[model samples]
Target: MAQRLLLRRFLASVISRKPPQGRWAPLISRALQTPPHSPGDLTVTSSQARPLYTTRVCSTTFNIQDGPPDFQDRVVNSETPVVVDFHAQWCGPCKILGPRLEKVVAKQHGKVVRAKVDIDDHTDLAIEYEVSAVPTVLAIKNGDVVDKFVGIKDEDPLEAFMKKLIA
Candidate 1:
């Protein structure tokens, strides 16, 4: 009796939906038509199997290396608004926020430039800015920090703040 009940439920489920026929027909036909290749036919070597790091996008290549000796001259003295991201390598929130900040920079490519400062590497700069968090984004205009955000922030608010500052 239990087996019959299970079979009836299975039949109902099968009848309720159209079976995938046309979409899977070609794949099923191909699998039946092709003969399986032998191991010897495959020529992939260990070196070929493991691909080297290539085609790195500009965004992924971003790293927080030692800042220029005249960091202030480059960032604070810039004509356009400079958005400095103070982050550390070990911080999980920083990792997540880093890519989002990059998108914000790409969105405002000409109007603003983004720079990263590793608090672990440049402790002085972090101390100078009074940054006490992992992911802190500071918008600097005319060498003064006009706006700052700690932790993950919505893109709209950040964009609006930047637009107002730029205007």
Candidate 2:
């Protein structure tokens, strides 16, 4: 209960760009920094009283294969659209396209999933999907291959390709 109140006060003060004035000001001010300050010393400034905690939301938009589970899970099993990245480690183009494709898929913000299938690691999947070349990207939805590109694509075109899938 107290922590919630303190957080609310802190956020409110941060948004308002003013100190949280009241009986709890001293406590809140002390929690904001090391070395407690007296009640009269309570002053909230962006630089002096910023959020001490930080975190990054883990990404679920890339790499979903280490075994024979197949594309059904990431495609048909999932109602959302998925981008299947068919590539091989030795392929020079695959190295460049992987991260670019990931960034494009990530821009969709959970609306899409990027499933990477390494041709060498999962040769069956590659052959089944007719991935004759490395860095062959296929957009799948409801178990159907919808769209694709055979090699590396620049940022704008890649984003457009993903945006079409979500739309």
Using TM-score as the measure, which candidate wins? 2
What lDDT score goes with residue 35 in model 2?
40
lDDT of each: 0.69, 0.75
Cα RMSD for candidates in order = 14.4, 6.7
lDDT of 2 at 76: 57
lDDT of 2 by residue, 49-68 (tens): 45546668756455656545
Error of 2 at 140 (Å): 0.2
Clashes of 1: 0
In model 1, the Cα lDDT at residue 119 comes to 89
What is the alpha-carbon lDDT of model 1 when measured against the actual structure?
Answer: 0.69
| Tens-digit lDDT string for candidate 1 (47-94) | 322222445344412344656555676677879778888998899988
Query: Model 1 — which ten-residue stretch has the worst lDDT?
Result: 43-52
